[model samples]
Target: MVSKTDDKKAAPAAAAATAKPEEKKKVVSTIEEDDEFEDFPSADKEVIGWDAVEAAEKELNAWKDSWEDDDNETDFAVLLAAEKKKVSSAMKM
Candidate 1:
């Protein structure tokens, strides 16, 4: 029943109806190889002064002394309150 002209017109319509829509791919840009180390600074080559070293040692010694004093105290209530406060703060975070 179809003529050549009618078949030609219907051919395109039929093809279009059966064809699936193309999915668009997302493009993501990556950091260039040369810029990988650009965010970090160069290694420090300078020597630390003796005064700064002595001060750090003193601070660490003070912390050790405080820890020893705490060990002698054996206060369960204070330890429990500190733990509860730490847990509450962590939960909030």
Candidate 2:
């Protein structure tokens, strides 16, 4: 029953009816007092022993070796990254 002129007039009304109103959200204040702040545990100030230093060096070497092995394992690290992502997603399910 709507003529072309009537349809044009009704279009704006129909759009206005379906349109959502703008929402005003209250901004949360980020101001913090000294007492409100959490005290983080102080890290060890003492120097680490040679054994500890050696252990860290060994762990770093192991990681570097694994990285090198993976680089040798595939032609492109990009393919490996994609494969790793797929494996991670499958494990999640």
- lDDT of each prediction vs. the true structure? 0.47, 0.47
What are the runs in model 2 whose C-alpha is more than 4 Å off? Answer: 1-75
Off by over 4 Å in 1: 1-74
Which lDDT tens digits does candidate 1 get at residues 7-68?
54565555543552221111123435434443221121133346556546644343443443
TM, every model: 0.21, 0.21
Question: Candidate 2 lDDT, tens digit per residue, 6-85?
Answer: 45555555554355222111112333333254432222213334655654564434344344453534657778888899
